[model samples]
Target: MTISAEEAARRPLVSDEQIEDRVADLIGRAIKRKWWILFLDENGVQLPMIVPVDGAPLVPDEAATEHSIEGLRVIMDEIGAAEVILVWERPTGSTVTLPDRVWASSMARAARDRGIRVRAQLISHRTGVRWFAPDDYEGHLEAS
Candidate 1:
């Protein structure tokens, strides 16, 4: 079951925990591998639009990552978004893998390069949702 845009817009995803819970509710327990972007207003309230990048590679390609981020930037600007929260959804275990780190780093770098602020990075797996801390992608930054 999916949530209505109105309901999503009413919620303020200000904290990491709120973002994680909202993402978990959005994707649910069963899901395919994909990337989800939760757009937030300047006040940290969620926007009605949630962008999903389907069929993305676990180990993202540099060019593709940049292109995707550029597209997202356009959308953000059009919608007056102030920030975005990235969610990596996959039907796997909760353990953070190398590919996860790479994806997180790539997404973060691409967004940063485009002058987009990322509120938080998260991963939703079989067990639950978990945050991608700075440490999670520090080493993978160079590789990305």
Candidate 2:
């Protein structure tokens, strides 16, 4: 089933602040583990590029204007075989809304085209709180 951003905003769940906290905690964990963290602007250009998983902002605090597939594809082309592209997806409002299956599939295909393995994850505010596989937009994340 398709869930628009508007629909997700109205759902009963954790407050936006709590979601941010969760996301931050997740990002911190990834960084502490020394995994690679990537930050992308709305246009899909890497702001700081992929850095050592240090405590850093994987996603900016400001709202994203958009996450275009074209931009993602471009970034994917530059990825190396030994690298993993962690696509940080910011949740819309208080909910996480990923692109539809077709868009996601295309995004995944773009990464594979360059032999780069990509992982779609949610990250924003006070870090990466959750990790998701390429095709794992299962549903809205509920509050813990």
Best by lDDT: 1
Off by over 4 Å in 1: 1-4
lDDT of each: 0.82, 0.38
Q: Can you give the TM-score per candidate against the true fold? A: 0.89, 0.33
Candidate 1, residues 1-144: lDDT per residue as tens digits? Answer: 456778777877767787777877887563788888888999888898888888777687888788888888999999999998888888899888888888788878877777899889888888878887878886586754
lDDT of 2 by residue, 1-144 (tens): 333444433542224343334335334433222233454333333333444433323332212212333344455456522223343443333234343222334445545665544434443312345534443543222210
Q: How many clashes in each candidate?
A: 0, 6
Error of 1 at 1 (Å): 9.4
lDDT of 2 at 9: 35
Estimate candidate 1's alpha-carbon lDDT, on a 0 to 1 scale. Answer: 0.82
lDDT of 1 at 130: 85
Model 2 clashing-pair count: 6
TM-score: which candidate is best? 1
Q: How close is candidate 1 to the true structure, as a TM-score?
A: 0.89
Candidate 2 residue-wise lDDT at 93 = 33
